[model samples]
Target: MRLLVIEDEAPMRTALVETLKAEGYRVLAAEDGISGLELACTEPFDLALLDVMMPGLDGFALCRELRKRGKTMPVLMLTAKGQVDDRVEGLDSGADDYLVKPFSLRELLARVRALLRRKEREHALGNELSIGDAVIDFGRNMLHRNHKDQPISSKEAGMLRLLASHPGETVSREKFLDVVWGYNAYPSTRTVDNFIAALRTKLEKDPSKPVHLITVRGVGYRLEP
Candidate 1:
């Protein structure tokens, strides 16, 4: 999973980036709110850690702007202020959770895990994933499109689930192999390409020129939904 850390304190920012990385997450750090906003708007992230106190744009304003721009990623507000009104303001500004500064690393890690788990649960609540005119029903292993129901294999469904979960993020072939095919179960990356082709044939209006499931040249594929 990917996480964005927006904190002005150099030492705290580095510690956050390193800690999240050590937990096996891809981390991006910004020293200020403007840079952090740019990163948050440009790409998709699983979660964000925002420091409430900043020089120009405070964390509350940043969180509000993120919500205004339709970024739905969970945000954890970090601040030294543990007062009631400050916490209320953070939540009112669209933060999902709040953490006071000088917090234990163990507690921070626990909060991160809890937020990520909640996000996964939110994604799982919907078994039907829609891409353009096609709707994939994972529960029944069927694709509903062209006014008809088409059968899709378990592997195909798994690939779609992974891609859909990440949305615009590029999912590498190695990641697909590990998640869908159980690593050595698929001997070559070519197997992934073939499965993608099959999915396009089934889901795309014109499989020769797909729009939803896109290939990223040397990289893997991304679901445009």
Candidate 2:
């Protein structure tokens, strides 16, 4: 998954980025709220992590502006202040979740998972995926393309859904394993390539020279449609 982290502290921001990257997320970060807001508004991130205290625009204002602009990406507020009113303020400002400083990494990871899963479920209401000439009936595990409809595995459907969520952006192989296949799953990184190859055959006009499912040199794969 892609995430935006807006934090002022150098050390804390670095730590958050490294930690989330290790967990297989593509992250964009900014040290000030204005820069953060700009990046958040421009990028295709699945979530945002905002530090509550910052110079100028602050987390609350950034989040409120994001909501005002109709960006429904989930926001998680981070702060050292752990009082009742502070929590209420975070929520009132449009943050979906809040995290206190000096938090256990385990718990923080859990909250991140929960929020993303909730977002995933909300998107689940849509049972079809349309990319280029291909249409996937995820509800029925079928892929229709080139005037033919063929059966596909649940894992393949999940992989396509995840990749489709972020179009025209490279999704890392690590993210593929972590989100679609789960972190602890036994598949190695090569599994992503194999899946992509199979998917190309199903969705692309030429599997040997794929167009829609293009590999991003050293990073991962990107969907053009």
Candidate 3:
């Protein structure tokens, strides 16, 4: 899974990043709310760990803005404040969960797993999808192919899900930018190209002559079953 950690304290941020990485999650970090908001809105992440106290924007405001833009990815608010009202306010601001400072890493991981499980359950009820040889078990956030398991990163899985939902139809570049990247920032087309290349490499029988994922000359891409 990919996670974004938004915390200003250098020590805390470093520790969180290292711990999450050790747990096998790809992580991105931002020092303040502005950068956090930017990364949250521009990058593909399965979840966000946001510190409520920070310079400029603050986690509450950032969470609100993300909700306003219809971003429903899970958010866990972290703060030194440990009051009932504070936790209520964090949830009201769109956080899926709240964590008090000095929290055990074990508890944090547990909450993350819970939230992802909930999301997967919700996704399963909405669509049944397949990409290449992999059948997506959205309720489990898992992909199964042949008798072996293909370990896919969360971002890659999200991209594949989108493609699978519209098999045989072209998915626009702008749609990918808005959905996968999340915000209005202009990343080079190369970014999309690179991800597609990576996806093809992992999922295709012949990466050089992909059968399921095809590039449209001047448009975007189409997935052929």
Best by lDDT: 1
The superposed Cα distance between candidate 2 and the true structure at residue 203, in angstroms, equals 42
Return the lDDT, model 1, position 193. 97
Please provide, for model 1 over 68-112, each residue's C-alpha lDDT reduced to its tens digit, 9 standing for 90 to 100. 887878788899998767876786687877888899989899888
For all candidates in order, the CA lDDT equals 0.85, 0.82, 0.77
* Every model's TM-score: 0.57, 0.56, 0.56
Worst 10 residues of 3 by lDDT: 178-187
lDDT of 3 by residue, 54-128 (tens): 988888899999877767788888899877667656766777777788999998888788767756754654644
Better of 1 and 3 by lDDT: 1
lDDT of 3 at 122: 46
Rank the candidate models, highest lDDT first. Answer: 1, 2, 3
Best of the two (1, 2) by lDDT: 1
Per-model RMSD to reference: 14.9, 13.7, 15.2
lDDT of 1: 0.85
Error of 2 at 122 (Å): 0.4
Stretches of model 3 off by over 4 angstroms after superposition: 127-225
